[model samples]
Target: MFKGLKPIQYAGREVWPLIEGGKGVSATNHASSGAWAAAGGIGTVSAVNADSYDEDGNVIPQVYEGRTRTDRHQELIDYAIEGAVAQVERAHEIAGGKGAININVLWEMGGAEAVLQGVLERTKGKVAGVTCGAGMPYRLSEIAKQYGVYYLPIVSSGRAFRALWKRAYHKVPELLGAVVYEDPWLAGGHNGLSNAEDPTKPEDPFPRVKQLREMMRKEGISDDIPIVMAGGVWFLRDWNDWIDNDDLGKIAFQYGTRPLLTKESPIPDIWKDELTKIEEGDVLLHKFSPTGFYSSAVKNPFLRSLQGRSERQIPFSTEKAGEHTHQLDVGVKGKNFWVAAGDLLRAREWDGQGFTTALKTPDNTLVFVTPEERAMIRKDQADCMGCLSHCAFSSWKDHDNYSTGRLADPRSFCIQKSLQNIAHGADPHENLMFAGHAAYNFKTDPFYSNGFVPSVKELVDRILTGD
Candidate 1:
């Protein structure tokens, strides 16, 4: 037995309680979000580096011509604004007065405020709301209010929402569309795990969401405001208890990973096929993103290479001390490099295996890699467009002299480049792929039997049956 969902009032219209989670780098575009909205659910167009088309209808490739990181960052912001405005306009047109259309952006992305303002100014009456996460977007409410649209702040915990309410959101409560409670442990892409939370031990989202509601009540916020549950959502039947529960208040569901397999999904066919092969534990939660946030991705060759590079690391000192009594003879041309005796032997072993290059990390550690790997790392770092506010990979900061004042880390990669490549039909195994933990359900769900992929409407209709 399953409980069916009822249409709820959103943006002054009746629509299903379902929502399509926004994915970045052209993953969620007009085709997907439009069809989702037409199916009577809220659809979110990703405003993070979305794609814009040429006059002939081909997607314009985003090629950076600026020589400096700051110059290129401006180019990126312009591209982002144009792309998001185009996407929202097209998505609204496709919806045809059916369901609401929202745009999602990462607060930590470079020039996030500028891009958001630009898109909102251009797509005045087209977009219904804005969804933001990845950092504390204290100005999101004000920006949404300026454009006469609702704002949804994605948070992982009740404490975070309380902080936001106390800081800025309380001033503009009317246009607060929904609070998205994204499960940090189960969510894909960048997670919101704080220093207080442990990565290994997963907590049940029911209790955490209940706490969020209780906090909201303390602030005198009405129960009518839906708390959209995102991340790890697969079959709606598993969440039957959450529906119509008094303690949880108004509830909604957001699908991030499940929507990627639909016919309207903008992801490449190779990515869609790869989603069906995921097994339990195949998606790993790791801390290798340039933004310094924990993210989840398939443990493919690209991710494994980062892991191996990190594993082959050792702490070094400029001069010999108590623990660093051995002089490093391999990988480095400098004679001042010192390491422990055990590390010295390991470095020699790695060098013998052709990992003859050593790169320094920001944490005073050295990672061994082959010459070709080192060259690729250097090239990627040089090609950075300052996508993030603060990037650990290239040490490129968005403000204050455009540097993080730390050594450029080799453990992370340029997320913008990899994501752009993957979105435009790059090999999934060689680029970064973001997915939720429940993605494994794609392989076992009977609705997807015989390699069948449903249209966005079919998927939405099937979901209403509690499948």
Candidate 2:
């Protein structure tokens, strides 16, 4: 049904209107990317920990081996680059005779430039463009030009677009293909939600897209440069009014969560079922991340556990200034419960529930709960393969020193280990599951069969035809 659509010029290549948003970990892979490209549009393959595995699913050799954080990060860079190149080659092969293929990069991730260079140098002319987000990719234009590929920056506002254009647009003018406007409130993964933009106030995207288009034109950016709309994009009918409009003449739609249901998507069936049964308030945007940014995810047992921990925590002062700080003797052998009067009741409640295990971190801070839960946490830590550059749970970092300076926060977990587990069909109740708010629609949408599976073509066609 996407017939008769005019070709949009992107990085010297004519591409279709569809652009698939990149999802990390194995969610958005070469198969799904190739399928999207096969539809004559731009398909983005995620490169987060790209060098994570080889064709046979084996780990590559460490590129660096030093105690320092910089050294460790450097090694990670080399591995990621090699992995990205492999993924790109696979995607290129699958694209076959289809349209252009693009790579998605997370600027916040360690070794961003090295990984990009690795993919570009290896792929050479095979890749058409690179899309970067998670941070303000100030040097993206420079990198894209060096590799001779188009660049697309995912932005949330017109002001952000203007700022990037003024800083780096001149050097890579020809390479600026499109601007992805991801709705901070509606999208999954790391959100761009600002302090002022309340989650309660859901803004219509059409007006925002129009504003960005006008801002682009003011900055001498041509009208031909498409503004790709992402987040909460379920069906074409939801965006019918935004499409083919004068203000947003050349527009494209990017799908992040909806693509997970497709056959080409790499997520397991168990995770897909969770998305189907999710309710309206089941998806939450929380500020618990140590990155100091908001993230969206399902309110499953994993998330609820964290929420409960936050609620039960109390401030303790060394001075004898508070009424709550009291040394209390415990019946358990060789254990003392340092409880505030307020926390005393909570501790008693846990004790009545038969929770006897109390674990302490390196800082000597205690978290008293159930032994069974602690064992699960310990198992999750043991299974960690050091996916993220630094993890609070395992205290694993690219360097000997804390890279993000957040190794002690109980609020943070090893994202890599948890995501990998969930993606591999591990216990959904324990592992964190990232999803868009529109995930709940899976239950009502006829496009999904039994809330479990749908072919890539079917999902894409449903999006294009608004079914």
Candidate 3:
């Protein structure tokens, strides 16, 4: 159907019209990417925390004892590199004789160089390209050139693209394969929010993609440099104007969420079913992450917990003399609970809602909840053998000097622990499932066959042909 489209040369290999966006954890694994590449398109295997598994599919021992975030982050990177190498080898074997395989990297994640180096060394020339996001990857071109691989940076705006071009594109122009313009609001995972951009404002991605093409041209990058459009892209018919058009320049569509419903996608069935049944407005962009960035996901029971917590919170200040000394006594004798008026009222509300139980700590801090909830929290904490450097769930830390410093925050849960659980078919309601806003279309889309999952080739054909 897209016969007029010419094959673009990237990393010295030709690829088809499709480009699969890299998903984190085991979501976007080698099997899925290899299937996409086997269809003559580009497949990106997510390498974030890539070295998470050992040769026997078991999690390797993490060296970080929660002492230092920096030290823990480094250890995580080493493990990620090892894991990525294993994934690449598996993907190459599956690619068989189709298109090429690419590795996806998060710039903000630690051990970017080490992970890439390990994968490249193991795969040798089998690795075709590297796609990076999460931050401005200014050194991508330089790194890609060293290994004779193509580099594509994911950006949300033309200005961001130009900044990278002026700094690095001038030197390794050939290494630049394409510019991926991911819709910050529509795509899943972490979004690229500008300082001035409002989260409520829904910006049209078509104009932005065109704007990026013009900016690339101004920077000496030609029309030949493809612009891969991601996020909210479901059907080619919705973007017919972009294809075979001179004004928009050469373009390709990147799918991040839709691919999850395909047979080759590694997401658990529970996750796919949730995406299939999601309502139009169910996905929300939230700011609860410690990374201080907005993340997109379904507004399920998991998200409701965070929302409820946010709504009940009230600001407390010890500024005024009269406001500083007032305290109310509640909970057990040894564990006394002292809280502001607002906190008491919220606790009462929770108590009335069957979450009855209150405890006062030796430090005079008050926490309210049910005995069952407390037991579950304790179980979750006990199960945590130190996933993150200093988890808020178990209060585990790598260092000893700091209280909350060395201890995990009781308020926050371990993301890795919960996400891994959900990814492996655990109860979806108990864990967070991140997805793009376009996930709702799966319900009505005829191509999905009422959530009857198709293979990667079938899904890609539907996207290209608009069936």
After superposition, the stretches of candidate 2 with alpha carbons farther than 4 Å from their true spots are 2-7, 51-75, 322-340, 351-402, 405-407, 450-452
lDDT of each: 0.94, 0.73, 0.73
Provide the TM-score for each candidate, comma-separated: 0.99, 0.85, 0.83
Residue 60, candidate 2: Cα error in Å is 7.4
Candidate 2 steric clashes: 2
Candidate 3 Cα lDDT to native: 0.73
Using lDDT as the yardstick, the better of models 1 and 3 is 1
Best by lDDT: 1
Q: Which stretches of candidate 1 lie over 4 Å from their true place?
A: 1-4
Estimate the overall C-alpha local distance difference test score of candidate 2.
0.73
> Per-prediction count of colliding residue pairs?
0, 2, 14
The sequence of per-residue lDDT tens digits that candidate 2 reaches over residues 126-242 is 788888877788899999989888899988888788888888876678889889999988889888776778877878878888899999888778877889988888877767777
Give the TM-score ranking, best first: 1, 2, 3
- Name the TM-score of candidate 3: 0.83
Candidates 1 and 3 compared by TM-score, better number: 1
